[model samples]
Target: MDRVIYNFDSLSQRQSAATVPLRRSIYRARRVPEPRIGIIYNPRSHRNKGQDLACAGADNAMVAQPRTRDEIAHALAGFAREGIDFLIINGGDGTVRDVLTMGQAVFADRWPAIAVLPKGKTNALNVDLGAPADWSLEAALKAYASGRRILRRPLAVSRVDEDDPAMLGFIFGAGAFTLGIEAGQEAHSLGFFNSLAVGATGAWGVLQALFGTNGNKWRRGTQMDLRYLPGGAPLPRSKYGDPARRSVMLASTLERMPMGIQLFGAPRSGLKVAVLDRPRRRLLAALPAIFMGWRPRWLAEAGFHQLDADAVAIDVAEPVILDGEAFPAGRYRIEQGPELTFISV
Candidate 1:
């Protein structure tokens, strides 16, 4: 856990410290007035090369290398103190979540807009923002310098207890699917095909475990009470809730999944919340939908609702993974927060 923090007076000052070759391109753009920019990067992040390149491309970007989760929060607090106008996060989903969580506390006044550089195994949030999957620091800076506008949408935040603050952006889910993410991280560390490959393998492992002798271990499924607020209908409680019903594999953005597949519906479907469910069918049903776009319909038929609400709540007996971070094993509530605005290329 390393933390580096800097405050530059101008984009030209930032360009001077950039190490990427593409920084020159972004340096030529018009400079905005003292736009205090704060950047958080994970030193141990997998995509260091891309992050380095993106850092080199930005102007007047203050870089922080936070070693621990709390350190990252402190660095964000410093940025807020400096009155940062924009925050460019240069890591994967986990890093983004950490920064957003810190931002809510340090920059609660709706200042410091966020821009993302997807440099992680599963960049679901980056993909949603339409940022380049292969984003280098230089490319990211270029996009910002080229006058690209940032889009703000609501974010889903959640927490398990009063002592813990809510997580920023994304949903919570349990069952085999959530467990698969854990397995995928292990496979990824063991030299697998990165996050996407790890996810695929993890899903397979879940399937195998479900049918194996130990399958009965997790058979005592927990209960999930979902309530749609603002006058939406309440879902009827069912005894055997489909594992898929308890699970949600959704990307809040309009982009495709990392595997180049459209897990949600269409690009236009970006504005709406996409929910895929079917506990009874499990991955057996989701596999076909990934390749053929046919399974989501079945999931919808099984009472999986896809609402455009900015907020939602999930109360469960077991712990749920929001984005990629795991919370305590107990009931939790998730609701949509403010929308993160980004400048896309």
Candidate 2:
């Protein structure tokens, strides 16, 4: 990877020039302190394209390493031991999830604040945090150096079993959709774009499972029990009164929904959870709901039952995908956890 070096003195002058207004805003909010950043970069991430780009932009300020989850957690634990104030993770979604999970395990107060540099195939979490979809490390650093106030939102954590540790990102279900992702891993050698092509192929597989000649498995349907722990009470099953009961695309989060889709309008406080369940009806009724540009009033009228508890559990007869990764089939649960902060531009 090509490397570029910006003299520290010049960089400092540039930052001072850019942050004048932002610094004033910070002072008004309250006394702001310099954040000690712990960076985790995946040397082998995204076919090494992201890594090469990041390496080229090293002068922008980064800590480069080929650390895994355990290594990163230990490093962060060391930083916490030394009193670091924040963390900046530069990798893909899996890297972000690992750091968040490790933070939960290490710091009682949730380690340091986090900022992500989108360097992965699917930076879903970063997108939710308002980071630019096409962001490069250099661009991210400029925004960081400008000392702007970072917009932060909470995150939802899920666990496959009681004994299993919680997951820090999204989760999904639906037959071939899950299987196709599993199959795509075999073609990782094709590189970063390959991963995306693999994902597109996976989606195609899902469509084929739903409509093509090879649709027997999906058509047969698998039975699974989905329970909502709304404010700790089992949501009463009403035909249309409770929205959470319906299952089209179930997502619970304190962050924005992906693909610019707002399952529910922006949530105000606590966790914002939305469940999209497909009713056993004609495809026409579902097609409109899926493709309609406007917010469906039915979603609002069909009030969602609040899962009062910090976490909600999901039981499945088959293996489910959490952020596109397949796990052993069985019961699973979802819940909220400590806030992992992020810097947004």
Candidate 3:
């Protein structure tokens, strides 16, 4: 199935370091004393497979390579018990999502400051934090000791029917957005990543919808019952379009995305959303401006809806992608999650 989140074979796939052209210059810092930091390293991230993270030299640095949720929670619990001052996430979006999701149970309120070494296939969070592809633990430790940091809140998603606590992440999307990620995985296999992968996948998806026959998956859209949370009112249906069908629905907490894409209009905080009520013929030509964050005055009337959301209730029969992973179809509540401080230097 195209919508299936991941393939195990792909998880262990390896690519030569020279092939990825994002950034090769390593960010270094002068000698700085390390603080008590627990490092959750993902050996499976794109850049971290064969190379060991070089933080073992620091006296206060502790590293854990956890392969399961239980192990992640256990590691975080140990960190919390030891009262580490800084927590370093040494992977990309998926690893970061896993840490935040499991760490919530271990650090409920008094969360430790985090520093991410963006080594994932898609490092959107790192892009927002201005962390380059070569950002290192040494640089992060220097920034931390210098007291430089920024705050960001993750998106908390919970099924309305389940008793489980909300899953925390930075990006969330369903419908066509899910398709885009599926294409992105293929792009990654071809040795393209970050902005190039994002652009290629997006172009492929758009071209398919534009040239494909009627009733295609992209054109048909997904059946979703979306309404604002705590209010229970539906978003107004577009002119002559089905109220429950949307071609694209994406939400994010980041100010800047890969390839400089921002469907939510401008760079602002909180949950910014973009939902399109199915694709139309007129939309084909406007793709360039739309991807560039341009919003025409008549766009809202044509079914392109941008929302600054507090919370939303979603009921759909298709899988939704959070970060780079997928969740099954069901009724879900999406809201702002806990605020966390991160070192930005």
Candidate 4:
């Protein structure tokens, strides 16, 4: 029997080179060449209602105003048909969600580099991507032509059955969040929006939960179970609290949330989740600290749980919010979706 010996070092070097990510070279800083850009403008968006697009002179771009959801899907299909290399979303978070949802088929397998004009009532995605509130269509176009590209993977939530279209977004909330959003709407009607609205709504929610007693809907919360899905393990539960239900359940792929609030306390990308097993008086007092990302021993004692995972199964029977939109109550799987490149300002 003839024996052959292979050099382990050589084999390792070959394997490493084969796995060297193409992104190192493919994403090298360079001018985008005659990019075909598509702008999906929502005329009803708070800031975009009266403002004309600033990049009208850019012949390489095509603008579409889509009012209805079906119109949005049609507009995206048209843009895809034109072979757009870049897409600029001009609206708030909800509009962005609409684009991502409707255009999923058009951008299957690969998505064009995207840019966002912070023209919505709540531009949380813009905040995370460092696109300031003043990010304009012209600036977005300029960035698309020459600017740093940020690669982000938005969270995708789908029903457990996987029979329906999935929703792609940065933030998701349930339980108390659904109640809070109702209050936030009242705040919005009063001209409070963005971070201020969030603070107000959260404060109101805390008050309701604390003073409304156990039977109050906000305080009563809803029944939900979070289990680690494939590629993740069941997270550790605090010994002091029930392992099944949570009072506040929220998750996101964003590192920096809207209004500079650190909800995850040093979030580690992917899908980071925070589940509070109902709030006690002490937990209510510590919420400001929690919002500031300060995790204290007392908070953990009160059942504050945060973790980063690849996927989670949420068996929820209450309405859920995805990027500011309401979704019907049901069991769903939340996970990190495809990588999307953004043209940073």
For lDDT, candidate 1 versus 3, the one ahead is 3
- Candidate 4 lDDT tens digits, 191-243: 98777888888889888877887777876657887889885466555664445
* Candidates' C-alpha lDDT: 0.54, 0.49, 0.78, 0.75
Give Cα distance to truth, residue 174, candidate 2, Å: 5.9
Single out the weakest 10-residue window by summed lDDT for candidate 1.
Answer: 1-10
RMSD of 2: 11.0
lDDT of candidate 1 over 113-206, digit per residue (tens): 5678777777776665666677666665556556466554435544444445556654344655455666666766676644366457646654
What is candidate 3's CA lDDT for residue 226?
Answer: 84
List residue ranges in candidate 3 displaced over 4 A: 1-34
* lDDT for residue 9 in candidate 1, whole number 0-100: 22
- All-Cα superposition RMSD per candidate: 9.3, 11.0, 8.7, 12.2
Superposed by TM-score, candidate 1 places the C-alpha of residue 16 at a distance from the truth, in angstroms, of 34
Tell me, by lDDT, which candidate is best: 3
Segments of candidate 2 deviating more than 4 angstroms? 1-34, 47-50, 53-64, 145-163, 171-177, 180-206, 213-215, 230-249, 263-281, 284-292, 295-310
Write down the lDDT that model 1 would get.
Answer: 0.54
- lDDT (10s digit) by residue, model 3, range 1-345: 134553212111211111123333432222235457799999888889899769744566778999866677778878877878789999889899878887766766567789899888879898888877788878777778774577788998888966666778988898988888888989998998877888888888888788877677877889898888789988655873566688878878888888788667788899887888867768756967986877788787888888877898889889888888988888888989888887877
Q: Candidate 2: minimum summed lDDT over ten consecutive residues — where?
A: 1-10
What TM-score would every model get versus the actual structure?
Answer: 0.72, 0.67, 0.89, 0.87
